[model samples]
Target chain A: MASPAYIAVDWGTSSFRLWLIGEDDSILGERRSGEGMTSAAQTGFAQVLQSHLDALAAPENLPVIVCGMAGARQGWVEAGYIDTPTSLSAILTGAVSVPGQSRDVRILPGLAQRDRQAPDVMRGEETQLLGAIAADAKGEQVVCMPGTHSKWVRVVNGQVTGFSTFMTGELFDVITKHSILSHAVAGAADVPADSTAFESAIKAAFNKPALATNLLFTARAGQLLHGLTAAGARALISGTLIGAEIAGALSSAGQGAAITLVASGRLQTLYEDAFRTLGLTYTTVDADAAVRRGLSAAAKAIWPNNERKS
Target chain B: MASPAYIAVDWGTSSFRLWLIGEDDSILGERRSGEGMTSAAQTGFAQVLQSHLDALAAPENLPVIVCGMAGARQGWVEAGYIDTPTSLSAILTGAVSVPGQSRDVRILPGLAQRDRQAPDVMRGEETQLLGAIAADAKGEQVVCMPGTHSKWVRVVNGQVTGFSTFMTGELFDVITKHSILSHAVAGAADVPADSTAFESAIKAAFNKPALATNLLFTARAGQLLHGLTAAGARALISGTLIGAEIAGALSSAGQGAAITLVASGRLQTLYEDAFRTLGLTYTTVDADAAVRRGLSAAAKAIWPNNERKS
Candidate 1:
């Protein structure tokens, strides 16, 4: 068995994921929990990290590299931001170290677009971008990272020119759970069951992005008038949000820019289907692998001599 | 005071409002409560209506005129819908009576646009429309009725052409209360205190309706990066929703159609401000008065001889 080289962590607003990386850049062990920044802020960040390390039986001297909300002002420490248009590899130089930790621990900074008219910021996604796109890749690329806040980033010759974040996933959550649409979507499965409804909705919203709110209302109207199934209502909503998001993202993107979608599982499938339905070309990258590779990049940059002793 | 001629009630999904109308069309007494269709459906619709009637202490022979959710299938009686493009007066003949009631009781039907692609339904707003626009009025008219579900209707000459319903108000409610923006808007007043931010957001969304969801995320990003206040966040959300709605609503309406904004109090002011910010001219109508006038129109059509005794 290879010895653990370092720990890579992605600490988000409501989730925490840690991977113990071997000297050969392989994953030795992984830990995940709901103890993200929000929880750790109350439970003590150091204690949360120690408990996870203890569970994995990680060596006491193993160093850790962290990304995401752990670097926010409200997180473990403030790592600030690197404003665009900046090189993707520049993030590796912006890591801020924890002062009192027994083991050497550092958190990567986020990226911020400071345009007063369209100000935007992202924490964990910058790390994902670091690993998803090659630093020297040619041509313009539009990368979409879908989640609670779906980010659409534009990379021109390997540098992030700018990005836009759409509250698609979170809006869907609030609408289906807390709005009147809750009744329309009640008892529906997590994933959409009606592909036909989803595709139609995607086309409808893509064609008339202005009618998004109106389209969302059709979920209930469709149920009441057309007897649209609960699953169909859910799909309508999911498709509408994703459709509008894609339309908005592509509006500012370069014409026919190569699309790279960084996502996994349900989100990945949904986006891939959306792109296909809209007839837009795209390539998919595993989100988990991207973030891990990003954290590993930072680790290697920070400690070059930690290679596996065969 | 003139003797009561008929009882008028707008029993909506979450609210109940009753007015005792005199022979001369004067409101002699009124009763309001939160016992709308949802509560009444569980607590007994007849009992709820009777309690309000008992509180008014009206004549036993006085017939009741109803509108809104009371006519829903899940309400007291299924009043059904008047499909467009029909005359505004068509709603008058579509009222369904509540069976087994001691006194004559009738509930007004809603309006339905059965387009398979953009199907929409409005229960109470139909009444508001009947009063907001004159039956004999000439030219194209676009009426904006803002509420939980904002209805934007188009009237060509005297006939109701078609309409669209935007889930603006409901989306605002859910986004502010249940989404991550909830924290961004916490401690802020119900209405926005940041007019600058509101106007700017309105213009931004009006110009690029496709970017509505992206603009919504700026509420959070603005706070994180620009130190935006709770008021700014709330205003941004409100402006974005309203701006996008107006853009979408106008997209289908005649270019020079006169806009009639039928709303009362808070919603009225907010929408008026939105219209002004977008430089769209509109005339205002008291929503409360409009609904009452609509009920009176139906009552008169049903019973022509029920005038004041000279």
Candidate 2:
């Protein structure tokens, strides 16, 4: 078996994923937990990282590399942000070293679009973007990294011109669990996906994005007036949010820019469905693979000598 | 004092307000409580009503006129709905008498816009609309009732055309309390309204309604990037939601329809500010008075004899 070289972590707002990379640039061990920034902030980020490393029985002096909220102002150490229109390769060089650690540790900085009117910031996803698109990629590309806060980046040639963050997933979550629509979506999880309802909602919201909230109300009204099932209501809510998000994202995209969707699991499926339903052409990239590759790129750039086989 | 002729009540989903009307249509007594349909449904609706009535000590034979969620399927009694293209006066005649009640008690029917694409139903707002706009109102009138579920009703002449329900207020609430943005607005309640932040957000959202969810995320990003105050974050959330709502409402309105804003208290102030910031002409009406007048209108239509001097 190959020896573990370094540990890579994607510590987000509410989730933590760690991968042990071998000297041959292959994954040797992996761990995932709910101790993202929110949890780690209270429990201590260094302690959390050490505990995970202990579980994997990592080498005593194994170096660690982290991307995401762990580098946020409130995280382990504020790695700060690299302002756009920046090159994808710039992220590899902007890694900030964590001081006072027994072993060498570094965290990648996030990307910030400081447009006064549409100010936006992102963490962890920058690394994912780095791996998702090639360093010398040509032409206009719209990269979508969908999750709690979905990011839509506009990359012209190799430069990230700008990006917009839509609170689609979090809004859908909070709306379902806390809004009056909660009652309408009860028992939705027990039922299958309502494709018709979902498709129609996507179209409706895409056509009239201004009516997004109005369309959300129809989730309940549809049930009350047209006998729409709980599953249908849930799908309608999900589709409406995703639909409006796409509309807003595309509205600012460079004309004829090819879409590259970077997502995994349920979000990937939903976003793919949404793009198809809206008659928009797009390609998909596995978010997990993208983030891992991004971390690998950073590792190779920072510690070139560590990549040799044992 | 004039003899009590009847009792008028606006029993909503989460609130209960009752007024004792004299023979001359004067308010002899009034009662307000949180025993709305939700509470009343759990604790017997009749018992709740009787307790409030007992407090007011009304005449045994006094007829009662009720509106709002008390007429909902899950409310006190199923008063059903009056389909749209309905006359404002039709609401007064569509009151359903509660069976098994000792005194004559009638619950006004809600309005249902059974448009397959945009199905909507409003139990309480229809009454407010009836009172806010005259029976013989001329031209195109856009009635904006801002609340938990803000209603924007389109009335042509005296007939109801259609209405859109925007989950603006409710979205603002859930997003603030349950989403990641909650931390951004932690101490907002302790500070004064951030009008500049509010107005700019309104303009941004109004100009591009599709970017509403994106704009909402700015509340957090703004706090982090620009050192925006908690009050600024709160105002930004509110303005974005309201801005999107107004844009959607006016999008479907007639070319020259006058906007009538029916709201009370903080909502009234916020909405008025939103309208003014947008440079839109609008008239204001107290929501409390509108509902009361609506109940009174229903009472007169049902019991004409009870409205005259004793």
RMSD of each: 1.5, 1.6
Model 1 lDDT per residue over A82-193, tens place: 9999999999999999999999999999999988889899999999999999988998999999999999999989999999999999999999998989999999999998
What lDDT score is found at residue B7 in candidate 2?
A: 94
What alpha-carbon RMSD in Å does predicted model 1 have with respect to the real structure?
A: 1.5
lDDT for A73 in candidate 1 is 90
lDDT of 1: 0.93
B1-310, model 1: which lDDT tens digit per residue? Answer: 8889999999999999999999989999999999999999999988998998998898888988999999998999999999989899999999998899998899999999888898899998999899889999898999999999999999989898999999999999999999889999999998898999998999999899999999998998899889889999999999999999999999999757789999999999889999999889999999999999999999999878777432
Kindly report which residue pairs in candidate 1 clash with one another.
none
- Per-candidate TM equals 0.98, 0.97
Instruction: Give per-residue lDDT, candidate 1, residue B101.
Output: 94
Best by lDDT: 1
Candidate 2 shows a clash count of: 0
Candidate 1 Cα misplacement greater than 4 A, ranges: A308-310, B308-310
